[model samples]
Target chain A: MSRITECFNNLKSQGRKALIPYVTAGDPDPKITLPLMHALVESGADIIELGIPFSDPMADGPVIQLACERALLHGTRLVDVLDMVAEFRKTNQTTPVVLMGYLNPIEIMGYSAFADKAKAVGLDGVLTVDLPPEEAGEFNRLMKASDIDVIYLLAPTTEEARVQKICAAGSGYVYYVSVKGVTGSASLNVAEVAEKLKMIRKYTEMPVGVGFGIRDDASARAVSEVADGVIVGSVLVNKIAELTGNQEQIPEAVAAITASMRQAMDK
Target chain B: MPTKEDLAIAKQMPDAGGHFGQFGGRYVSETLMAALQQLEQTYEKLWRDPQFQAEFDYDLAHYVGRPSPLYHAERLSRELGGAQIYLKREDLNHTGAHKVNNTIGQALLAKFTGKPRVSAETGAGQHGVATATVAARLGLECTVYMGEDDIRRQALNVYRMKLLGAEVVSVTSGTRTLKDAMNEAMRDWVTNVDNTFYIIGTAAGPHPYPKLVRDFQSIIGREARQQCLAQTGKLPDALVACVGGGSNAIGLFHPFIEDADVRMIGVEAGGYGIETGQHAAPLSSHCKPGVLHGNRTCLMSDEGGQVIGTHSVSAGLDYPGVGPEHSYLQEIGRAEYTAINDDEALHAFRHLTLTEGIMPALESSHAVAEAMKMAPTMDKDQIILVNLSGRGDKDIHTVAGIDGINF
Candidate 1:
C-alpha cells in the first residue's frame, strides 16, 4: 500500500485523526530540515508535508510565502528538497512525506523524472498547489506509475460536480481548504467547514484533510471532529518564520507547536 | 512532446482543454478551476449568442467608441521613403486606450454572471483605469491590485483610477511588479470566487482568457482589415503591434491568421538591449516554455525556475511572461516576434510625435520602432498597419523624468 494510505489506515484504527505538519524543506537552512522532519515525527505527526520552495506561491499568504523566500535565499533546488526527504526516510520510514509546491519547478525538472526521483527518495506523494486535475493528466500518470499518491485540493468555492471529479482524480486524500482566502489569511469557522465537509464526503470515500486555516489545537480539534485529517501549515510556518534568523531554535519551536496540536487532537 | 497535429491547430486553438498547442492550460489551483470552467462555458455561449453580441456591440458603438480610424501616416511614410504606414487608432477609445475594449467585454460578462464586485491587477494602471471605468458604468464595485513600485512609477494613472473610484491596493510581493500584482489578484479571486470577477489586463493567465480577450480585441483587426481593403484595395502587406501580455497584438493578429498574404510581427520591450540581459523579450531572446501564473508559456526565469525581474521603459511591457498563445504562435512560425531597445522605442516615440502630431504610448512605441525599421526595407507600394494600442499621455511623466524635466 502507499505510505499515505497506510498512514491514514493506522490512524483510523486508533480512533484518531492524522496530524500533518508542513515545513518548507530548506526553510531556515538545508542542514536543519532533516532534524525538523524527525522532530515532527517525534511530536506525533502522522505525516510530513515538505514545502518545495517556489518563487511565486500564489495560493499562500505572506507567512508561507516568506518561508519560501528564506529557503530560496540559500539556493534550495528540487534536488535539494528530494535529498532532504531521502535523508529523513533513513530514520523514520513509517511517516509519509508529501512534497507540496507549485508546478514550475517540477515542470522544469520534467514530471516523469521528478516522479521517479521522488519515489526513489522515499517521498510518498505530492500536492502541487497550482495543478488541478485538468492539467494533471501526465503528472498523474507518471506519479501513479511511480506508486506515489497524487493529491488534489478542494475549496469552499468548489462546486459539487468538480468535487466529484477532483476526488475521482486524486488519491490518498483530498485537501479541503477551510476558508475562502489564501493560506494564513484567516481563522476557520468550524460549523461552515462541517457543512462543507458533509457535501464533500458525498463525493468520495478517500480521507478528507482540512487545511488553509487550521492554526492552533483548538481549531485543529474542531476540524478533526469533522475531517479525516487536520493539516496545519501557515501557523506552524509562522513559528518557523519567527525563528528564521536563529539557527538552533527552529526544530524545537516548530515541534513544540506541532506537539500542542497533536495533544489537542489526541485528547 | 507536442505532436505535429497539435501545431496545425493554432488557428482553432484551446481544443476543449485549453491547450494552445501544449502551451495554454488552466494550471491554477482547484479553487479557481471551477471559476475558469464557468468562464470558459459562459464565454463559449455568449460569444455565439446573438443577444450578448448585440449588447457588446451596443456598448462598443455608443459607450467605448468603435471603428477607431485607420489613418495613413503620410508624412512619416514619406520621411522614411519606404512602405506606406497606417495606424489603427485604438488610442481614440474610451479611457484613452485599447484596454477599455476588453474591460467593457469582461464587465459585461461580470454583469451577466451576476458578479457585483470586480477586481483587476495592473502595471501602469491603464487596465485598472479601464476596468474602473467599466465598473463605474455598470454600477459594480471595483478594486485594483498594483505593485508598490508600479504604483509609484505610474502615479498619474494611480490617481486616475482612484478618481474613477477604484480601491487601488499596493502589492509588495516578489519584486513588486505586474507579475506580483497578478499573483495577488489570483489569490483574491480564489478567496472571493462567489462575488468577485477578476478582469485580467493582458491576454495571458489560463484558458478562455487568451481566447476571450482576443475575441473582444479582434475588433481592431476586423476593422483594420475592412478599412485597408476599402482604402488601399488590398490587405496591408504586414501587421505590427507591441506585445506586453499580447492582448493588443493578438487582437490585431487573430483575424489575420489565415491571411498568409499579410505578414505579422510582434515587438517586445527590449529594455536596454537583448545582449544586456535587461529586457522583457521572452519569445525573441529568452524563449523557453515554462508554466508561470496559470498557463504554460515562454517565461523569463533563472536556472532554478524562479521567475526573475524584468525591466522596460514601458511599464506595461515589463512583464517576464508572455501569453501562452504567443508561445504557440512563435513555435509554429505563424507570426514573428522581435525586440526594440528602450532608446529605439523612445526615438520612435518622439519621431511619431513630430511627424504625425500623435503621441504613442511607450508600450505602443515598440511597434512603431519596429514598423519604421521594416518600413524602410520594403517597397513604397507595400503597406504596414500598426495597432497604435494607446495614447502617450500617461507615459509623459516617465518620458519627461528620463529627459530631466519635472512634468
Candidate 2:
C-alpha cells in the first residue's frame, strides 16, 4: 500500500479523520519552507501537500494565485521545489509529500526525468491539476515504475463512465473538487460533495480527499465527516501570504490553523 | 521536379513522424506529453479510418464551403501591369477566414474523443470566431481567450463571437496579445484536460496541432490546385501568402512544396524594418530555435528568452513566432521569406480596396505587397496565386486610421 493509503487506513482504524495541509513551496522563502513542513507534521497534519508554483496557475484560487505569484517572482521552479523536498527527506522521510500544481513546469522538464527526479527527491505522489485520467498514461506509468502514486481529480461534473477511467488511472488518493469553478469561489455545496464521494466510492477503493473551499475548521470538519481526508489549500496559502517576509508569524499562523483543523476533524 | 501526378503521390504518403519534412514534432509539456502522444497515435490510426475521413471531408465541403472561389483579379492585374494575379479566396469561407476549415475538423475530432467543451485563443478574432462558430454548430460550449488589447481593437469580432454563443474571455496577463492569449489557452487546457479540447488557431503550437491544423487547412491548396488547373490550364509560377503563425501559408505551400518550378514566398510583418527592433519578422530578426506554446520553432526573444514585443498593423500577424513548417522550408531552401513594412502593407491594403474592389485583411495585405513586388519582376504571361487568407472587413478601422483615409 502507498504511504497515503496506509496513513488513511490508520486514520480509519482509529476512527479519526485525516488533516491534509497544503503550502506553496518557496512561498516567502525556501529557508522557512523546510521547517514549516516539519512543523505541519508535528502540529498534526496527517499528510503534506507541497504546491509547485507555476507561471500560469488557472486552477488556483486568488489566494493561492497570489502565493504562487510571490513564489514565482522570487524564482521558484520545479527544480527548487524538488530540492526542498530532497533536503526535507534528510531529516524526515515518513510523511507523505504530494506535489500539486499545473503541468507546464513539469512539461518543461520531461516526464521520465521528472518522475525519476521526483522519486529521488522523496516525493510520494503527484497531482497535476491539468492532466486528466484519460491523459495520464505515460505519467502514471513513470510514477508507478518509480514507486510514486499518481493521483486523479474527481470533479462534480465528472460522469460515471469517467469515474471508472479515473479510478483505473489513479493510485494514492482521488482529489474531489468541492466546486465547479476556479479555486476560492464560494459556491461549494457540501451535500453535493458528499453525494459525489458516495458515488466515487462505488468506482474506486482509493481514499477521497475533498478540497477547493475548505476554508476554516467548521468547513473542514463538515467535509471530514464523509471524506477520508479534508484538503485545505486556499486557507493555508492565505496564511502564507500574510506571513510572507515576516518569518516569526509563519509558524504561529500555520500551527494555529493546523491545530484547529486537527481538533475539528477529530471531533 | 514532381509532376501533378507525382505531387499526388507525395501527398499519399503520411509525413515521417507526421511532419512535413522537418516542420512538425511533439514539443510540449510533460503533463500533456502522454496526451499528445496518444493523440498522435490516434490521429495516425484515424487518418485512414473511413468514418473519420468521411466526416471530416463532408464537413469541409458542405459546411465550410470548401473549394473557395478562385477569382481572377482582372482590374488589379490590369493596374499592376499585364501580369495576371489570381486569388484563392479563402476569405469567402464560412466564418470569413480560412481558420474555420481547421476548427471544424478539430472540433469533430474533439467530439470523437468525447470532450465536452472546446477552447481556443484568438488574435485578429478570426480564429476565435471560427472556433466559436464550430463549437456552436457541434453543440459544444466554447471558451475563447483573447488579449485584452485585441478585445478592444477587435471589438466587432468580440461581439460576433459572443453572438455565436461563445464565452469570450479577455486575457489581461503577459504582453496582452496573441502570444499571451495562447499562453492562457494552454493554461486552461492544462487545467481542464478532462473535458476540454484546445482548438489551436494556427499551424503552430506543438507537434500534432501544427501538423493536424495544416492538414485541415490543406483543403485550400488541394482545391486551389484543381481549380487553378481547370481555370488557367496550369499551375502558377509563384505562390504568395501571409505568415502570421503561417497556417494559411503552409496550407497553400504544402501542396506545392515539391513542385520544383513553383516559387513560394511567405511575407512576414515588418512593422518598421528588420533592423528597427519593432517588427514581427521572426525569420529575419533575432529569432533562434526554441520551444514555446508546445512547438519547436523560430521565436523572437532577447538573450534571456523573454519574448520581445512585436508591432504590426494587423493583429493576426503581430505574433513573435512563425510556424515550424515555415522554419523547415526556410532551412531547406524550398521557400523564400520576405518582409512587408507597415507603410507598404497599408499602401497595398488601400490599393487592393481601390483597384480590385476587394478589401483584403491587413494580414492578407502583406501577401498583396509581396505579390506587387513579384508582379513587376515577372513576365506578363507568368501567373501568381495569392492565398487571400481573410476578408478585410475586420481591419477597416485600423487601415483607415493608418492610411489617413476618411472612408
Candidate 3:
C-alpha cells in the first residue's frame, strides 16, 4: 500500500481525522521549507502538502497566489522541491508528503521522469489542481507505475456522475473543495459540504478530505466531523506571509495554527 | 505521433474528446469539467439547429454588418510591384474588429442556455467592447476582467466597454497582463458557473471554447473565399493574419485549410526581436509545448516551465501562449508561422494608412507587415489576402504616444 493509504488507515483505527497542512516550497526562502515541514509534522500534521509554485495559479485565490509569487521569487524549481522532499525523508519518513501544484512543470520535465524522481524521493502522492481525470490518463498511468498515489479534487459543483469517474481514477484519498470559489475565498458552509460528502461517499471508499475554506480550528473541527481529513491552506500561507521578513519565526508561527486545528479535531 | 495520413484529414479536428493531436483538451479543474461538457453538448446541438443558425446569421447581417468588403489595395500592390494584394475588411465590422463575430455567437448561446449573466476577459479591450456590446443588445448582465496594466494602456477602449454597460474589473496579479486577466475570468466562471456564461474572447482556453470560437469566426474565411473567387476568379495564393490567442487567424484560415494550393501564414509579435528574448512569438521562436489557461499549447516559458513575461507594443498580441490548434497546424506542416517586429508593424501601420486610406489595428498591422515582405517576392499575377482583423481607431493614442505627440 502507498504511504498515504497506510497513514489514513492508521488514523481511521484511532478514530481520528487526518490533518493535512499545505505550504509552498521555498516560500519566504528555501532554507525555511525543510524546517517548516518538520515543524508541521511535529505539530500533529498527518500529511504535508508541499506546493510546487507555478507562475499562474488560476484555481487559487489571492493568498496562495501571493505565496506562489514569494516562492518563485527565489527561483524554486520542481527539482528543488523534490530535493526538499528527499531531505525531509532522511530524518522523518513516516509522515506522508504530497506534491501539489499545476501541470506545466511536470509537462516540461516529462511525466515519466517526474514520476521516477517523485518515487525515488519518497513522495507519497500528487494532486495537480488543473489536471482532471479526462486528461490525466497518461499521468495517472505513469504515477501508478511508479507506485505514487494520484489524488483528485471534487468541487461542490461536481455532479454525481463525474464524482464516480474521478473516484475510480483516484487513489489514496479524495480532496473535496468545500466551496465553489477558489482557495482562500469566503467562509464555507459545513452543511453544504456534508451534503456533498454524502453524495461522494456513495461513489468511492477513498478517504475524503475537505479543503478550500477551512480557516480556523472551529471550521476544521466542523469539517473533521464530516470528512476523513481536514485540509487547510491559505490561512497558514497567510501566517507565513505575515512573518516574511522574520523568516526564522515562520515554521513555529505557521505550525501553531495546525497545532490548534489538530487539538480541536482530536477533541 | 499522428501519421501523414492523419494530417490529411486535419480539417475535421478536435476529436470527440477535444484532442487536436495532443494539443487541445479540457485541462481544467474538475469544477469546470461538467460545465465544459454541457457547453460542448449545447454547442453541438444548437450549431445544427436551423433556428439558432438563422438567429446568428440575422445578427451577423443586421447587427454586425457581415460580408465586410474585400478591397483590392491597388496603390499598395502597385508600389510593391510583385503581387496583387487584397484586404478582407474585418476592420469594417460594427464594432471595428473581428472579435464581435465570436462574442455575438457566445452571447446568443448565453441567451439560448438561459444564462442571464456573461463574463469575459480582454487585453486590447476589443473583445471587452465586443462582448459588452452583445450583452447590452441581449439584455444580459455583463462583466469584463482586464489587467491593471492593460486598463491603463487601453483606457479609451475601457471607457468604450463601460459605455456599453460592462463592469470592468481590474486584475492586479501575475505580471498584470492578459493571461492574469484570463485567470481572474476563469475563477469568476468557476464561482458563478450556474447563472453565468463565460464569453471567451479568443480561440484559446479549454476544449469547447477553441472549437466554438473557430466555428463562429470561420465566417471570415467563408466570405473571403467566395469574394476572392467571384472577384479575382481564383483563390488567393496565401492567407495572412496576426495570432495572439489566434481567433482571427483561425477565422481566416479554417475555411481555407483544405485548399491545398493556398498557403496559410500566421504572424506573431516580435517585440524587440525574437533573438532578444523579449517577444511573444512562441511558435516562431520554437518554444516548447506546455499547458496554460486550460489547454496544451506552444508557450513562452522559462526552463522551469513557469510562464515568462512577454513584451509587445500591441496589447492584443502580448501573450505567453497561443491557441493549441495553431500548434497542431504548425506540427502537421499545414501552415507556416512567422514574426513581425514592433518597428515593422508600426511601419506597416503607417504604410497601409497612407496608401489604402485604411488604418489597421496594431495587431492586424503585424499581418500587413508580413504581407508586404511576401508580396514583393511573388509574381505580379499571384495574390495575397490579409485579414485586417481590426481598425486602428482604438490605437490612435498608442501611436501618438510613440510619436511623442500629446493626444
Q: Write the per-residue lDDT of candidate 3 for residues A42-105, one digit (tens) a residue.
A: 9999999999999999999999999999999999999999999999999998999999999999
Top candidate on TM-score is: 3
Ranking by TM-score: 3, 1, 2
Superposed Cα deviation of residue B198, candidate 3 (Å): 0.6
Model 1 agreement with the true structure over B253-277: per-residue lDDT tens digits: 9888877668889999999999988
Which candidate ranks first by lDDT, i.e. highest?
A: 3
Return model 3's CA RMSD, one decimal: 1.2
Span of 10 residues, lowest total lDDT, candidate 1 chain B: B1-10
Q: State which candidate has the highest DockQ.
A: 3
For model 1, how does the per-residue alpha-carbon lDDT over A65-141 read when each residue is reduced to its tens digit? 89898998898998999998888878888899999999888888888889889989999989999898888888999
- Which whole-number lDDT from 0 to 100 does residue B225 have in model 1? 98
TM-score of 3: 0.99
Q: What are the runs in model 1 whose C-alpha is more than 4 Å off?
A: B1-8
User: What local lDDT does model 1 show for residue B343?
Assistant: 96
lDDT per residue for candidate 2 within B234-344, as digits (tens), equals 998999999999999989988876677888899999998888988999986637765566655677755423356788878999898888888877766677899999889
True contacts kept of each: 0.76, 0.01, 0.78
lDDT string for model 2 (A1-267, tens) is: 777888888888999888898999888776778888888988899889998876555555557767776776677778889999999899986789999976556755768989999989988999877666544567788889999988878776677776787788889898887775566666467898888888899988888998887888889889988899988877777888877868767967887898888987887
What's the true lDDT of residue B31 in model 3? 82
lDDT of 2 at A255: 72
